[model samples]
Target: MEGQAKGLLKLINEKGIHRNTKFLAIASGKGGVGKTNFAVNLAYILANDFDKKVLLIDADMGMANVHILVNVNTKKTLKDILNGERIEDIIFTTRNFDVLPGFSGIDAINEIDDSAVYKLVQNLNDISENYDFVLIDTSAGIDNKVISFIRASSKTYVLTTPEPTAIMDAYALIKSMKKLYDYSNFKIVVNMVKNEDEGIETFERLRSSIKKFLDIDVQLAGVIPLTKNLQKTVKKKQIISEVYPSDKFVLHLKKIAASEVGEPAPEIKEGFWDRVVSFLRKEG
Candidate 1:
């Protein structure tokens, strides 16, 4: 199995990475590791630095807080879509990108039945076509909802810190990615690192473990340093990327935006949203 996996990974590399990546999921194995903050800043960098039309979807469900980070007092969400509001009406525009704020009352994802899923999939597809990138800030941990989003997305960037627990949970998340989703191609963002060496070591530790156990492919997207008054900026309800464009962490984000991302230039596996539509149809 390990040999076969290596052969498949070699073939994937020989074919080059897929370029027409439309939906990207930013997720974590545990909360409070700055996953949402990373997603928000990545969207900003992709839009402002790379000139991509980006949409950041706050898909954290019951713990939605992208609005708080961006200082947008949003009133409508997926719930409002059921009340006859168009998805376009619920989107809040920002300086660099757009946001579809998540619903934050209870576990709203459970309340979304097949009909609601169908409605959301349709509206989401319609709106998503206009943008170059759609970043879903998924809820943390190995929750089924998070798995579904990661499964549906074109790319998954698992966020982790240098903390031992974060690394352990990140490996667990990768295991679930392969076990539950039958997916293993993942990009890792080691955030809040003390230095470059620490970041590289952290990624290597996670990678070696994953290679020994999961036999999966994982790429280091980039490393964010523990620089700047990031928490203070977050408290101001502002994105650090925008607030401190010259910060080391923001520069690392820019590096990821430029190197890890590209225009939708190549053909991609189409009908992902349609698959969701079909699932909704079957459920209904």
Candidate 2:
């Protein structure tokens, strides 16, 4: 499988048919805010609805569950790649898109050294150019691992709810990250909102805080409504966009996807590989 994937990638490059892939990281400051579900559904919408190839990386290293949410069982994960397995062999392809499952319950993988982490990022960057988008579902919090992924991506989306605690934490994340890199490209997405008015209010509050304190402008991506059917879809271990195509929740997601479908990815000041290596070295 690894060889075949490589061969296909080579053919595409030879034909001059590949485009620059966009790397987007979806993260939050606290868990249970439905960040992973949003990442999975967004990937599905980009692939199935817009006919764009997408790769979803479960970057929640220790407690990854994107595979479970999508109801796909995998024998290997990012740990295997670190243990010398070909990245192509470990990638699980579904009808919608490809997934690079993350490590779960493996202490060594969870505590991977800077060198190993850099290698993993490099491998992902190598194959990323083959796809239209690479979306990473990062672990919640402002840890080194989480910040590293955000800094390396073309755009980092901070997810939060209307709750005050979640909102504060989200702001703290942006503030912390701003200290290390530019915050001009940060995007905000308010989730589990009761209505458009609620979502807009939440976004405004966060944006005002950032501008006043951090002095940076964050773009509003889109708002996801709180729908009862979303819980049912998750319980059934299915993607909302696919199972409930016409659901209001899915419709809003499609709107977000349409907004970004053909836009060129922002050019990183330093290349992806260089940025990853520089971040690791600084942390080391």
Against the reference, the lDDT scores of all candidates come to 0.81, 0.84
TM-scores, all candidates, are: 0.86, 0.88
- What's model 2's lDDT at 266? 71
* 10 residues in a row with least lDDT, candidate 2: 103-112
Tens digits of per-residue lDDT for model 1, 1-284? 99999999988755533324478889889789888989899899989888888989887877899989999898888668777799889998997799998875424544567677677678877777777788999888875454666767777899899999999999999997797658885899999999999999999999999989989868899899997579889878878988889999898888988875653443446556765445334333
lDDT of 1: 0.81
Q: List the residue pairs that clash in candidate 2.
A: none
| lDDT of each residue in 19-122, candidate 2, tens digit only | 77788999888788888988999999999989998999898877889999999999899778788888999999876699999875434534678678777767
RMSD of each: 9.5, 5.0
- Model 1 TM-score is 0.86
Q: After superposition, which runs of candidate 2 have C-alpha atoms over 4 Å from their true positions? A: 1-18, 104-122
> Cα deviation of 248 in candidate 1 (Å)?
0.3
Candidate 1 residue 75 C-alpha distance from true site, Å: 0.6
Weakest lDDT window of 10 consecutive positions for candidate 1:
275-284
